[model samples]
Target: MLHVNGEAFEVRDAAVGESLLFVLRERLGLMGTKGACEQGECGSCTVLIDEQLVCSCLVLAAGAQRQRITTIEGIATETPTDVQRALVDAGAVQCGFCTPGLVVAAHSLLERSPRPSESEIREELSGNVCRCTGYGRIIDAVQRVAVSRASAREVGL
Candidate 1:
């Protein structure tokens, strides 16, 4: 059994060496976790395991059996998350192949640091590689979400 997206799923017919990325996208049909670089070089397979951002491609599926996993699908509800909306509003999404990883990384950063400096945001998101948008818009989107969240907190919203 694997815990994913706040639900438990029984994994079946999985090989011993199957990567978590394969289990997520292939076995469970959670295609949000992309498999760009199976060697963990690219952040396309980024996911949250026990609230820690990790490259799913590097993790063994069987090893992640009891851990809490959160994919891109798990990050948003019926309505898009502020980070998701901010990315779109700021024109950060280009090809969109890297958007999910960027969104997850930014969300994790904001959860840890509600008010991060520009450099901090860049450092936090350094692992995620966006081939498009040149990263300026992506950084801007993260900052926008941070500012919006801070304002909401101040207004007690």
Candidate 2:
């Protein structure tokens, strides 16, 4: 059984060595987690395990038992979060293969540093690679979100 995306699922036939990535995509049909590289080098399968970011591909399904997992679907919800909107508005997503993991990583960064500078955002998002754009827009997106949050706090939103 797995608790994923705020729901409980019985992954009854999971193999002992099966990864949480496999369980999320193949067994549970949550395709948002891309299996790029499958070696944990790429952050495409990033998910929050007990609020800490980890590569789902590196986590064995059996090891994930009773742990809370939050995927991209879990983050965006019905309405996109500030970071998601900023990324789209800044045209950061090109191939979108790395967006989910990037989003998860960015969310984690913001949780730690609400007003991260450009260098901070870049350093934090370095793990999630994109083959499409040069990451200028991605950096801009995180910056925009950071600025927006700062503004919102001033306005008490």
Candidate 3:
């Protein structure tokens, strides 16, 4: 059993040896956790296991047992997450293949360090590769989100 997106899902024995990414996409139909390089280089299959970032493709299904796995689908409630909205507003999303992972990574970073510097943001999101963009815009997106979130917190929003 895996608790994902605040829902309990049972994984059949047939998928015991599969990767978490496989289980999330094929069996559970949670395609927001995209899988690009199965080797964990692309970072497209990134997910928050107990609030810690990990590549779903490299994480064995059984290894994620009892962990609080949060995917892109669980990042926001009624509207898109602040990170997601910032990415789109900053034009950081290009082909969108890497958008989900980027959003997840940004959310994780912001959760840990709400006011990360530009250098810190780059270091945190370095694992996520975006072939389409040069990453300048992505950095801008994360910065924008961090700034606005701080502003909101100050006002108790």
Best by the lDDT measure = 1
Tens digits of lDDT, candidate 1, 78-120: 7999999999999999899988888889999999999999999
- The candidate scoring highest on TM-score is 1
Evaluate residue 43 in candidate 3 and report its C-alpha lDDT on the 0 to 100 scale: 91
lDDT value, candidate 3, whole model: 0.89
Candidate 2 residue-wise lDDT, 16-63, digit = tens:
999999989999999988888988888999999999989999999998
Q: Candidate 3: which stretches are off by over 4 Å?
A: none
Q: Report the C-alpha lDDT of model 3 over 16-55, residue by residue, as the tens digit.
A: 6899999999988998889988998999999999889999
State candidate 1's TM-score.
Answer: 0.98
Question: Over all chains combined, what TM-score does candidate 2 have?
Answer: 0.96
Those runs of model 1 whose alpha carbons end farther than 4 Å from true positions after fitting are none
Residue 1 lDDT (model 2):
75
